[model samples]
Target: MKENIIALHQKNIAKGAEHLFLDKGFNLTSISDISETSGYSRRTIYKYFESKEEILYYLIIEGLDHLVQSIGDAIDSEQNFLKRYEAICACMLFYYENYAISAQSVNRFQSNAPLNMTTSVERIFALGVKINEYLSIWIEQGKEEGILKESLDVMPTVYILSTNLNALFELVTTKGTYLFASLHMTKEQFLSYGYTMNLNSLLKEPTK
Candidate 1:
């Protein structure tokens, strides 16, 4: 009963913080804002979370959990390596579009290492490793099926795919409107081209 109450408080705090972070961004949102939004006093908030960054970390963990599950399900849904790859891409696009704040949390942490690392940070890193492992498994399966180039080094291929895909997602999230307007392209067109281009690079014979 005691544990359940604590979990409840933490959940409420996370919900409120996510809203404020989405509305005003992590850097701009304040503890006072979280307290007011959550209807929890400042003392109660502090008891639950040491800092605002910790709250953001909580959200990141939750988001990455969902992402991992989505990617796993996508891979399981398709026997064809190419189709599985496409499904993974679609899942990432959906995640970034709907969970913008969580996406931003990941990007921010990746670019800037936190000064004082905590257990939450460790978990975040572990989740990242898990994501890379999923990609590695997908690549290995593709190679075994003779779908991906036999000569492809798994880690390097995973690195390229992960890095480039993140870059593409970041570009769309940050500058999609401006870029699409200037290029006379829609977001769907841009992303479709990006996804296909990335997919083609790994095929034993590039897609025509």
Candidate 2:
């Protein structure tokens, strides 16, 4: 029961951090803000987190864990390598489109690398490691199945995919309308165009 209570307190603090960080922007938010927003005492917050950066790291990990779960489920449901890859893209877009604010926050963090707190930088690197592992596993599977070309360098391909996806999300969350509105493209439509190009370039043709 004591452990259960501690878990609940930790979760409450994390929830508060998420709300305040998103609402006030992480840079502008303070512990007082979280205390007022979450109704958790400063002592309680400190009990669960070493600092504000720790709280933000918790939120980032929470978001990444959720995305990994969704992507895992989507990829598992598909038998075809290419289809699994497509499901990966779909799950990614679903999360971004639904959580555009978080996406925007991530974009800001990426572009403002100098402003990154130690905890946030470590957390992002941790997430990058997870992404690289996932990309490596899936791309290797595709190679063995002959759906990805045999000559593909897995790391380079992974880097290319990750880099472009970040750029795509940044654009869609910011300056999307200005960059794409002239072409009468909605964000989803624009994403589809990007996704299609990636697939065409990455996937090997089925044997006749």
Candidate 1 residue lDDT tens string, 1-208: 9999998999899999998998898889999999999999999999999999899898888888888888888776755787888889987877777766777777665666555678998888888777778888998998898888888899888879977888999898889999999999999899888988998898888885
Judge candidate 2 at residue 65 and give its lDDT: 67
Q: After superposition, how far is residue 36 of candidate 1 from its true place, in Å?
A: 1.5
Q: How close is candidate 2 to the true structure, as a TM-score?
A: 0.78
Tens digits of lDDT, candidate 2, 27-77: 898998899888988887898888887776666666666677777676567
Candidate 2 clashes between residue pairs 3 or more apart in a chain or in different chains:
none
- What TM-score would every model get versus the actual structure? 0.87, 0.78
Model 1 residue pairs with clashes: none
**Cα RMSDs of all predictions?**
2.2, 4.0
